[model samples]
Target: MKTEGGADAAKRRAGERAAEEVEGGFVVGLGTGSTTAHAIEAIGRAVDDGLDVRGIPTSFQSRQLALEAGIPLTTLDAVEGIDLSIDGADQVVDDADAAAFGTLIKGGGAAHAREKFVDAAADRFVVVADPSKLAARLERPVPVEVLPDAHTVVADRVGDLGGEPTLRSAEGKDGPVVTDNGNLVLDCEFGPIDDPETLAARLSRVPGIVEHGIFVDLADTTYVGTDDGVEERQY
Candidate 1:
């Protein structure tokens, strides 16, 4: 593992910790992110040591990383169901009363469309993150993936729903950031959400919306990494 110092080390601690959850014969949903990369590597090392498992990547980035790590890849079409999923979050907020955390915002990498599909399909979904991602409440810009032709309509609808939507642009290039599925991303800000479920429903109903970043009741457990150690929180 090319584990670095500071936040990267904390991320590694949480990620590798989640990787330990994998058992033999498990089909894993490999999520995308810097922190998730650590878990993928740990799983790959486990594979080298005779761990029998296959992984379904949430995005092209994850697919490539898994391959380089020597983790066997499988498709959702081939697997009956996923056993476990390990992923990182853009932000995770603590909820005093809920089955899972209050709110989770993901898709900073614009992979939420696929990430949500695989993560929600798993029997057990584990969230691994560095302490920086924890928040008092979710306030990050939500990412929504939509067909290119629907960008204008989606943005207007998002505004009608009281969110400020901005088309996500590719880094170091022109034009919008296109997802692996050839969709455009809209980063919508709605301030601190008091009713994530309602907002999620609203976003899902928008025409041409592929997926959104708001994840509620999906995470089974969250592992937050601090400089001291990995802090495990179950909801």
Candidate 2:
């Protein structure tokens, strides 16, 4: 859906803030999703401006976008210890309690596994989003990435958690959506996530589950863009 007041403008604001937070010879962790497209664009501009940055994109789509943006690309073999990651979110809550330990919820593009890995590896993860994406509570469903062979198994596990599981499918595509890692994505409809950190921990213990979209306490800070201006929340 097209966002009001121009989503591109919001993305540029958040991307600029994300760029300002990084430094020289940095290994950047990039995220997927439309909003993040703008961040990638900004990263390319940063490269042009002589910022020494190389990116590790979270998804194939993100990688292509990054390459198109003219940002230098590298792999984990080339650079150890990512300096920072900047990504967009479907919903973001910057409460100190929620983001204190680099936790968050992402994966609207079904790239949760890589997003989680990148977040865990980064020293700082900056989530960029428009102000409207903030939530009073994490009431939306969490997306879970699972092995294709374990779809039923994982769905049963999620059901035990009082959630209904449905395989996520792309537009006009049949069957479950497969991630870059060749896993299936299940949308777990848990009405409200009271304790995101706890839920994230619990999901980690589930067998056949590659990664859950509930990013708990991983976000060091969130840069929210609004029509009025941009704001920051430290967690």
Most accurate candidate by lDDT: 1
- Give Cα-based local distance difference scores for all models: 0.92, 0.81
The parts of candidate 2 lying over 4 Å away from their true place are: 1-4, 95-103
Please give the range of 10 consecutive residues that has the lowest summed lDDT in model 1. 94-103
lDDT of 1 by residue, 1-235 (tens): 5435599899999999999999999999999999999999999999999999999999999999999999999999999999999999999987556433546899999999899999989999999999899877788889999999999999999999999999998989989999999999999999987777889999999988999999988998888877778888886
User: Global lDDT for candidate 2?
Assistant: 0.81
Query: For candidate 1, what is the TM-score?
Result: 0.96
RMSD of every prediction: 2.4, 3.2
TM-score of 2: 0.91
Clashing pairs in 2: 101-217, 102-217, 102-218, 102-219, 103-216, 103-217, 103-218, 103-219, 104-215
